[model samples]
Target: MLRVHFTAEDLARVRVAPGPDPMWEILLSLHVLRQRSAAPVFGPWRTAVRATLPDDTRWLLQLAPPVGYSPDFLTPTAGSCPVDAGIEQVLSTPVASLRADLAQLDCPRPDPRTDLLAGGDTAALTALGDALHAYHRHALVPIWDEVRAVVDADRAVRARSFLDHGCEGVLAALHPTISWTRPVLSIESRFPQRDVHLHGQGLVLVPSYFCRERPIMLRDPSRAPVLVYPIARDVRLTCAGRRSLEALLGRTRAAALEVIAGGCTTTELARRLGISAASASAHASVLRDAGLAVARRHRNSVLHTASALGVALLA
Candidate 1:
């Protein structure tokens, strides 16, 4: 059990990452590569990557175990950071911090790889960086387009939950294993039990594509506080799902209906569809007439929601 202490102001500061962090994806994907058999969600990815696990990528295996602590240097505090930005942050880490972070990973036996990083060997560091880049490009890029779509969908739902029910609502729906009790938010880490006293820094909630059930957090609290949790494992615009959606509604209309399922304003729908508000409104009108969605006036904005028919169509 992990207890996270929070202040009143902390709740106000709570935020979800607007997008997936590339570095976090790399770190999590490494774990998936090592332990693909453990989670059914990664089965497809595992088969795909097995075809070509480059020899250079093995360097990453030394640090990323199927089950264990991850080096802090690989995970930066920023909500949205490019792969290079994160790699540069790791390279710039103080030798003391690197060694300290590596100390936690000395469990099964002290890994010799730690020495190279601890001693500030630029060659080893550069090689690690290169490995990460190659691994991400080879393994992740192919699926990234769909991956981003899944992540965006998750964020869309989370954002709606935040708007409708506030921070508590967001936390309530984050994951089944996580629970919030006012001042303290408890997470069933299922790891060695400990308490995280935020003191007041609040928490940054990040949604990850490759993360599994148990939520992940920064090992060093002295740094920025963050909790990286898994996005919906089954959420994806698969060829089957896409075809089904299109079958129920035409291709272009299916796209519009899919976005409407998340409950968006006309302006939001327009922006998402890359069409004028008038055009978006016209589509919404069609969906409304077909009993697939309902548009309700809320203040100055019209919010569109998927009706039961729409829900059944998607399900």
Candidate 2:
């Protein structure tokens, strides 16, 4: 894992000011760098690329928008989104073209074991690297600049509010490296840390940071393992107990628990089930009272994770 260092002041500035969009800027950078570096050695490993960054463009778009803003801004019809429909079309064409170009490039031919490795192959590798760099410099950078200009203009105020709310200090403590798809911001205090994960549809803001020092393996064989950090601590800030849970969990608390095996915030659960946040909270209360789930405080929100009993009951 590569560590990117930053001072506390830099962290604070990023928290307040609009920084690079992680999904488009950071993750994409990593993607290009990986392809340039690893493709020569590994022989064009597409799965490795997908593992690090999922193939879902919409998911990536969700994560790429500016910090503190809703993913709704990226929706095509919504004027709220930074990219206009016309601009989106323009930006997408080059990306599609690049993908096609890369796909057409020659990889290890069939029966490579029988073929002799040529010294001249280095030229081909060098050419690919130069092409990738040129694409990044010309196509990607321009599009990114356009996107950032619009997003930053709209979100400047909200970004400042986040900074005022101690986001800078939180980011300083966490010192997370920026990425395109993984837009992260945190606020740490003695009680719990607040973390926000920005996606295309919406932002998932956890009230407490979950400190998982080790990397967690994902069930998806195609995806890379994600390092689990404390994104939230006690989630009770949004849903404290049975009453609060009741306000959230809704009628089918048992079924919901089954779906959200890991845990989910009231907002996330409500959105997923097409219910209101208040209703979701109510459902959670019943589950909590029935000893099916546990609610804890993270930072400003509450998160509910299934208890072993809850899982067994669902089972």
Candidate 3:
């Protein structure tokens, strides 16, 4: 479990990135490109893009393997800039930071390019930037439309969640593998267990169409914390999916479903709906019994989230 500890200030500053970060998409997509079974969602994309990747991707592949550490400088600005601007940021990495980042590589293959990069060779840095630009052109630009569409749809869902339930709701609804419990948000990852302390520099949640089942975070803690989570796949949304609240679940019960869809504590549900706590509990009980909602005990409260069926109903 990777636990991110948040201070009060950190909690207040938590936010979703406005849109996809091209650099993040490029880095994580490398992982998918190198995998044989890149999950069902990405298998087809991988098949199509693999044949077109530039031969010199090793400039980045040497650092960003199929799995494990990638230099933090590669994604210096997260969602702050476009690919061209982001590439410049990578090229401008401070010499000290570059050397320190390169030294931490795990089992890096014997490559003179890695040595040149660690020594802050301007030519090597330009080459690295060129490799990134080439890879993005060949692999990401063609599928960029599909990537943006999925990420935007995911953001819409999260935006509704934030409006309904605030930051906690947005955190809780991030991913199934992620859990938000007051001051701590835990994520299941393939990396070794660790904790991140966000004293004041809040976390940036970047939704990536290429991020796989497990969320990815920077290995170095000193840099601004970023959690790149996978966007929902093939979420079937239709006008017919939005049925009248009074029809099947009744007015109040359906209202409860809507609130829970964004995720909230029982007390929060009661407060939002202007109902007594007991009433909220009873409605939640009925919903849980019918598999419309699911609850998890966290600390002293039970956090409720709409189940897949409940989300489908609210679609």
Candidate 4:
């Protein structure tokens, strides 16, 4: 069990990532590649990426084992940073931080690459940057649109949760395995028991397309506190799926769905669809029942939004 202790200030500081963190996607994807048991959701993705594995990318696997410590420098302590900015941070990691992070790896035998990285060799850092760029280009760029779509949808859900119940609500709904109990958030993990206290540093909730099973945290508690959790899987958009959805929901209701994709209250939806408020609510109910939309009560108003699956189906 992993426990994250938070202060009142920390709770106020908690916020979700604006979008997918490219470096984190790369690191977690590498960890996924090392796994023997394949998640049904990622099977197709893994198969596609594996077919084009580049030799240079293998070096990352040595550092980021499937179930062990990965260097903290690989994932910089920034929220929703671009791939280039993230890579630059990794390359510019101070020698002390690099050496300290690498030393924590529980490797049984010494490796030359690890030694060179620990010594802060400029060539080694350059190679690491190149590998990151190459792997991202080969393994992630092709499927990035899908990844971004899924993350955006997940963020939508979280944003609603936050609006409805504040930071606690968002944390409560993060994952089934994670429990938020007032001052502490507990996460079940395969590693030994540990605890992290966010002394007003807060926690950044990062939604990941490649993270699987449970949420992941930086091994070093001293680094910026982040919880990278898996987003809803199976977000593939197709014209056929949209056509089928429209056929099933009919034309006017389908239009309601399209409006809901941007998020709105019942009054806003009724105004946009030029329908009675009751009719708009009824259409939203139908869409919600079909698992295409979610309705959350925010005090006196109920806000409606397209679900991740719903957004994917539409597009």
Q: TM-scores, in order shown?
A: 0.78, 0.25, 0.73, 0.81
Question: Candidate 2: worst 10 consecutive residues by lDDT?
Answer: 203-212
Model 1: runs farther than 4 Å from truth?
107-112, 240-315
lDDT of 2 by residue, 208-312 (tens): 111122111112222211222222122221224566445444556656776555567788888887888998887777666655566654347665666545556
TM-score of model number 2? 0.25
RMSD of 2: 17.2
lDDT tens per residue, model 3, 1-315: 899998999989887888789999988888887777785767767887777667887566667777777778888875636999989988888899999988877754647888888889988887898899999998888766556644654666676577768898888878889898888999997777899999899888898877878787887777888889987665322122334322336788889989988778889999999999999998887776665666655437676777656777799
Candidate 1 root-mean-square deviation in Å: 7.7
What's the distance in Å from true for residue 41, model 3? 1.9
lDDT for 74 (candidate 4): 95
lDDT of 1 by residue, 1-315 (tens): 888888887888888887788888888888888885745777877877866889888767768777878888888745667778887887888888887887777456545555788777787788778887898888888877556655665676777678788898888778888998888788897588778887777788888888887787877877888888887664544333444434446666788889998889899999998989998898877776665666645437776767656666778
Off by over 4 Å in 3: 235-315
Give the root-mean-square deviation of each candidate in angstroms. 7.7, 17.2, 9.0, 4.8
Residue 298 CA error for candidate 4 (Å)? Answer: 13
> Could you tell me how far off, in angstroms, the CA of residue 120 lies in candidate 3 after the best superposition?
0.4
Residue 14 C-alpha lDDT in model 4: 93
What number of backbone clashes does candidate 3 have, counting pairs of residues 3 or more apart or in separate chains?
0
Quote model 1's TM-score: 0.78
Ranking by TM-score: 4, 1, 3, 2
Q: Output the number of the TM-score-best candidate.
A: 4
